[model samples]
Target: MKKIDLSKQEIEVVQEVLDHWQEQGLLEQSKVRELRENIDERGFEWKALARYAFWVALASLIFSVVSLFSDDTLVKFVERFYETPNLVFCIFFGALAAMFYVLGFRNKKKFPEKTFSNETLMLAGSFATAACIGFLGQVVDRNTNHFTILFLLSIIIYGVLSVKLQSKLIWVFTLVALGVWFATETAYHSDWGFRFWGMNYPLRFTIFGILLTVFALWGQPRISVLQPFQSTSYVVGLLYTMLALWCLSIFGNYSDFAAWTGVRQYEIFYWGLLGVILSLSLALYGMKVKDSVSRDIGFVFFLLNLYTRFVEYLWDNMNRTVFFLILAVSFWFVGRWSEKIWKKKSAY
Candidate 1:
């Protein structure tokens, strides 16, 4: 019953949604009547869009496959296309969108009693479309120039769709997409990437905050393990910290510590140890206070200890006994604290 103007790239999405809706026959009787009455409003545009998506799919596959036949195709393909992976990604998405429409029609008929078969189809189609395009670009050309951008688009798209649809599966995909993007981006760049700390840190922090907010809003009364954002929080948090610490460990000098303290090595070690202790203590406090985010942050500190120890002592293995001993003591303390919290709560 609603029609909206969208970008050229969004044609596939619109077509998929409409097609899925038509297939599911999910529109209410009154809504269906209204749609028919206003058939003149969007019918032609819709048909043309579906047709265009069809042609896009047909043409893209035909060309992509045909290109495989000619020796010149891969190398000689216009530099313009190479420059526009986004556009190519979009077209590839459009094509998969077309395929999804056909598949949705079949699935719709198969599950006639289902209320949201169409919405699922639409989202699944969109994700598949984006992934397929990305895969093609990544594999065939071996040029992953805009890969981060593409992955971000997919993740953002899934996040939005999940919210709109209230579909946990969509949320799951969104989280997975973000996790993969973070890992990929981080694994590739460490010290070299830290130079852009001023710009990248704020941007990433903002994104993380926003994602956490969205996740909180979406969760409403409580956070869900089912939530796409949940599993990734630990991973992404630890990853960012690992990267940041890598920066610190590489550049942190004893002279820098000497300014603040009497003995350089001992001071640095004390400060690091203090930070780890406080971070862990805060995590325990958070867990006691029922603050999930703080607890998560605390766990990240534990992860930091693991990472710092591994990196600093990989060849030397000097902290072997100390590391394991500290680990045991920390766990014991945490366990005692947890028992206290539970006992107090149980008494209440």
Candidate 2:
């Protein structure tokens, strides 16, 4: 039988739905196989390969550009041209960024199925955008040594471009720029201190993440146009908050690594306690609200918090072979449980 043509995402959703139905005893194994045979998937393996290939190509392009700058002949030739004006390099990359953005937009409209190729164009734009920002930084002179100004410019440019093009890739850079701006701005004001108001980088970022999450929640209803990014904003927020919590677990507001290591791990148990409390609280809130995204984030981080504590407290104290044996057993159970819950019975 000819399969029903569907995008990879659509196919995955369909498979999940089918699996759920099967698990509920609403679908037979034979019928599931029939449905699966009907759906024309390019297969996840191919999609994964394509995605990785795109990344490899992007990395190669970046390496090539960096190698050019490192080459003596190329560096001398560039230095000789137009007296090595920073303004020229800035304009050049800025123009290239604009061109790639235009190409990405056109291809997205014309060949929507060519996802990897379209994103490659956007990736090029991002590199050029960064280059433009770097050169602009070299050209600009300010009395202050703060580089937060560059991030501010990136936020403005990338934010505007994201909105104009409705490109998630550009929006990702915008979020990153916002993070950089916060970190840099706070560090600048703090006189490069590790602790500002008794909090370190991770703690500060945790607050930022919480604030961003709240903003996403509160702003989505009021701003209809921004609804598309509601999930993106929330995910980024969760990532920042959860990762910060993990960091705080290991080293509370201890400014220096040496200082942190000098103290016993048990002394920093309070931070780990806080992490466990926060993760579980979020997970419970997610369950109560029936929000899958929040629930998944909460649950994953809850497990992560527990493991982080285990690693911090028990890793060095126990014998290496024993530690890995326990770890292996734990993961085996987790895998078995997951397979039982999510995997369907074979059709054959």
- Cα-based TM-score, every candidate: 0.39, 0.82
- 58 in model 1: Cα distance from truth in Å? 31
Distance from true location, Cα of 39 in model 1, Å: 57
Q: For model 2, what is the error of residue 314's alpha carbon versus the real structure, in angstroms, after optimal superposition?
A: 1.8
Report, for all candidates in order, the number of backbone clashes. Answer: 0, 0
**Candidate 2 lDDT over residue span 1-348, tens digit each:** 566778788888889889978988999999998999899866457777889999999889879889989999998876777577889999999999999999999999999988998988987898799899988888894455778899899999988888787777877888888998998888888898887777899889889988888888897657876777778888898888888878888778788888887999789888888888888888789879978778788878888888887788788899999988988898798789668745543321
Most lDDT-accurate candidate: 2
Kindly report which residue stretches of model 2 are placed more than 4 angstroms away from their true locations once superposed. Answer: 5-49, 66-83, 283-292, 343-348
Q: Where in model 1 is the C-alpha error above 4 Å?
A: 1-130, 136-144, 175-194, 197-289, 296-334
What overall lDDT, based on C-alpha atoms, would model 1 receive against the true structure? 0.56
